[model samples]
Target: MDAIYDEIRVALHAVWRRRWLALAIAWAICLAGWLVVSQIPNQYLSSARVSVQLRNVLPGQDNLMSQADQQRDIDRVRQTLLSAVNLEKVVRGTSLANTVATDRDVADRVAMLQKAIKITAQADANIFELSATIAGGGASDAANARLAREVVQKLIDIFVEANLADTRDENSQSLRFLDEQIAARQRQLQEAEAKKAEFQTRYMGSLPGTGSIEDRAGAARAQLAQVNSDLAAAQSGLAAVNGQMAGTQPSLPGTAGAAMGPARARLATIQGQLAEARGRGWTDSHPDVIALKNQLQIAQAAARGEPMAGGDGGTPNPLYLSLRSMQADRAAQVAALTQRKAQLEADLARLGDTMGAQPGVAAELASIDRDYLVLKDQYDKLLASREQVSIRAQANNQTDAVKITVIDPPTSPRTPAAPNRPLLLFGVLIAGLGGGAAGAWGLSKLQTTYPTVQRLEKASGMPVLGGVGEVVADATHIARRRQLKLFAGGAGALMGAFVLLMGIEFLQRGLVA
Candidate 1:
């Protein structure tokens, strides 16, 4: 460790003794670098900052775009800001495309502008800053401002149109729902009314010259009453005959009284003689038989306490009924007719009331029907309009899926940021340093290492040997080391500064700080 320290000390001393040589080479390289940097063209950089203000079109609603999504949108917006279209437009509008204006100088400036447009987003920022550099051209400010404003306005217009289209679709959908619902309700009302009308007609009876079922119900009831009266009279006649038969009593020969007296006997003999005379092959309906039948009818009537009808009327069979089938059938028919009549009467009364009410209802229904026609026409027209609008929308490429504009307007530039002279000079200076270093290294490779060997041999004193000669030590390496040492003592001190400066420059890295 002590020997290594001693060698370091010796090497430092050797560098000090050759101070003029080190100083001259370093000075030459530094001057050349400075001169080369001075020859570089002046570059101007322009920058414009823009803020993105997102608008929530849904009123009173918060924006759903999260911070991450918003960041993506910002990046996307940044990309759009630096799109080829905008660049092409900028280039097309500028004099940068005309390569023959000042020929080489103008072309050089234009190429610089083309290469230098930059866009950047700050961390969690809503703003975009666009920057450009122009070499020998004037400034980069005004052109960037124009592009930002133009793009922003175009995006805004696209968004506004999209919003309008969405609103229109919403309105159209609402109208369609209303149309369907109204039509369904109308059908239901119509069906209910038709049912009511059919029931009214089926239950009602018809009458000649009668307009309603109620008008015929009264006549039906009157017919049933007359039929009932006829039935009662016929039943009474039958009852009378039955009563006469029941009251009649025959006298007996021994039990009740003595035999008939001479006058009753003689009278019976005369009646028997008369009946025998009339029964000579004569029908009961013959004149002679009819006379006898009448005499018997008169006797029967006398016994029954009934007046005789002109000696005798045609005697009917006691077991038979006039229009017999018709009696039962008419009774059933009457009952059914009466029931039907009653139902019709009720229905008719209801219908009359309904009709009276219908005067108001019918007016309303008529009005509704009339308005329905008008509404139908309007609905048809609206539907047709909607269809046409749909077609137009398709033609215009404005469909259910609309293009959304995510980009916003650009902010105004606060300052003209053109002509960044100091930054350009610094960059040029760095380039010059790099070039000088590369050149010095290449030259060192081309030159021989005889000087380095002479110094090494004089110091070590163990040289005088043959060796491979393809590779060599660097002349510029010595100059670089000396230059680094001088810079290390750059704190108001000379190149051969104090030991402290040397320790600070080299030993600090190797041994101790």
Candidate 2:
């Protein structure tokens, strides 16, 4: 412990001997540090908080812009608030504009603003916080403060403008795109319609039925089958009537002419019914046709056995005359059905010939019809989309989709937010003092002088039996006292300068306020 104390005492004595040099070093370092600190510009910050509200005034408008979409738009605006263009606008709108003379200067300022501006949002709210800082622009503290506030204000204006303008622009673009698509679709539809008309006129004008060749051919085949069935029924009915007439007597055994007997009347009724059934397109295999044929046979048998009473001269047999009439009607029906069948067959034959002559006609017609339908569908969809866009645009014009309220306007800062000058000044003073002390200590280490006999003995590795203290005269003591006072005054002056700088810093901040 004694040795450590001795060493500390020796170091102190060595530093004291060069106290002037140490004080000079401290003064030099302090002055340089103070100067640099004074040159450092103060930074001011301005901030604002805004709340955004998304409203849906139109019915079913949520499908167009949902809450998530609104949130995304808000987030997008927040992220782009400090973009280069916006920053340039800030620079031009604020005092920063005075410093920029050329495009390059503006660009440089924009870059700086990019770093100085910040936008943040709440996690679960629609509130956004915008802040901007201005520093070291050769402008006064008050000017910088005002610039910062102006920057934030400009950002707010841009935020609101961007939301409204972007919505309108996007809606307009969507409408234009839909219109173009609708027009293109319309042109395609028109061309398809014209092509279809030309194709029908050139290739399908003579074809029966409407639609493609295959459909017409199918319809013809179906009609031919129906005609054949009806013709067979008619032929069967005609044969039955002819047989009935052949069996019926021309006159009654006692009466020449008389009203038809009950059986003959029934038989004639059945014959008429048979003819009517055949006229209705009923085939021979139909249940009604079968039933009628059975009734007709029964009637014929009854008529054959019935005795007739009439005038002596035999009148034409009523049953035979009725059979003749039925035969004529059935024959006419048969002829009509035959003609129809022939016409249908000719149509089928013509369709077959057309298809064989032009194998691609049906395919071309089908493609034309398909294209026309597709174009029509597309045109309708585009028109609907255009209408939807137009409606949304109108709604947006009527009411704002996004509403922004300034919860906190940009504040005017009285003091700098950065470069804490007082703290920095104090720090520099302390550093200067430390550096001076370190310099003296290091200089002492390089010297061979020792303030204590023990240190001298240790360094020389020689035994010192004795040591003598220096004797000072009265005058020398007086001189030493005066020198000590001077050194104290120098150190005190350095401390006083530091205090003065701190006072000035506070006073400047007050003036700015």
Candidate 3:
């Protein structure tokens, strides 16, 4: 490294010593650089700015990109704006299209513009900007500006249009869902209304208000359980007739449904009384015994279905009336139970109609919520899509990022901003001086000089002599002076070449614009 540094230091000093050499090289390099700069065409730049946002449509987002998922969505939206298709359309249709720039050139310029565009992102933000620049002659400035404005405007239009399309879809979907619900509800309402109207016309000429037939039926059904319990107990008691007979005396002769036990029980009691009277050892002729025997015979006849002899006409016994009363009570109870069962059946029928027409309000609410959830998800997704396109568009082109608001436009240029003529002329003169100085310094660096005699003799491989002693001055020696004059003339001719080089640099810089 040190060696390299030392070499550079030496080169610098050498260049300094040969000032004209360095100056000549410097002028050469400057002129070349200038020539290149001049040849470069004067390009007209026109730019515009536009803003974007992705925000959830809650209330209003300043009427901008209002929607949730705005950042990622806006980024996606930018892609569409920066898309090759959109830029290509601008290239073909806009004022930039008519300029000297070709499709290939336009592509390259567009690519350069896309690279130059800037984009930034932050959480929960959807704002973005767009911009554009074009190269052309003086007249082309307006054309480029117009093209940029139109292209950016087109992008905004596309955004609004796309959003509207989505909104329309949202409306359409909601409308479809509502329509289906309304249609289904309409059918149900119609059926219910019809049923209610029919019931009113058929039964009372007016529909039952809330809790009419259904309420009554429900009450009746509740009672049905109790009624059934009572009926079951009655049936159980009736089933016990055989057991009652087995446990009872002859007063009941058969099972619950049979007869004859009451008569037999009275006959058996009368016979026992007769035996006790006889055991008293009374004669048959006695009035007490005869009286008892007469009673016994009458009771026996009655049990055997025979009529008893009496001074007065016979009449139906009071015990028979009691039996008839018991039968009547059982009949009345059975009839009452049968009537209640029939009424319950009629009430249940009425309840069925009411329940069938009833709407399921809770189920309807759940269905609506389900639909709304699905739509909300879809709305968020579409919003995200729009945002992404926007971000991509901004990043791809700086001008596309934000269309600038021009407060002042450019003024026309009279003389071209190039071709420093006087400067170039001064440069040519400087070059000539540099070349002459370099030639002198390089010559000075040599230790031996032909102008000196001692130096010349050593280089010629000859001995040094005190020539003063050997030869006298002559015309031949004087002729050698003529040869020296010719050499000086030849050296002067070489100086003309440096002057010629300087002229070339001047012309190149001055002529090109």
Root-mean-square deviation of every model: 22.0, 6.0, 20.3
lDDT tens string, model 1, 68-131?
Answer: 3334544554565444554444444554444335546544543444467666665636655555
Candidates 1 and 2 compared by lDDT, better number: 2
Question: Model 1 misses residue 396 by how many Å?
Answer: 16
List residue ranges in candidate 2 displaced over 4 A.
49-84, 97-105, 119-129, 225-339, 405-408, 466-473
Q: Quick one: best lDDT, which candidate?
A: 2
Candidate no. 2 TM-score: 0.76
Q: Tens-digit lDDT track for model 3 on 129-227?
A: 444443343443344344445555555555544444444444455455655655565565555556555544654332233334444556778777777
List where candidate 3 sits over 4 angstroms from the true fold.
1-17, 38-66, 69-75, 99-124, 133-161, 169-223, 229-336, 340-513
Q: What tens-digit string does per-residue lDDT give for candidate 2 at 223-309?
A: 899889989988998887777778878644444456567887687678767766664568999999999899888889998999875
* Candidate that beats the other on lDDT, 1 or 3, i.e. the better one: 3
| Order by TM-score, highest first | 2, 3, 1
For model 2, the run of ten residues with the poorest summed lDDT: 310-319
Q: Which model, 2 or 3, shows the larger TM-score?
A: 2
The alpha-carbon lDDT assigned to residue 214 of candidate 2 equals 94
lDDT of each: 0.46, 0.84, 0.49
Estimate the lDDT of model 1: 0.46
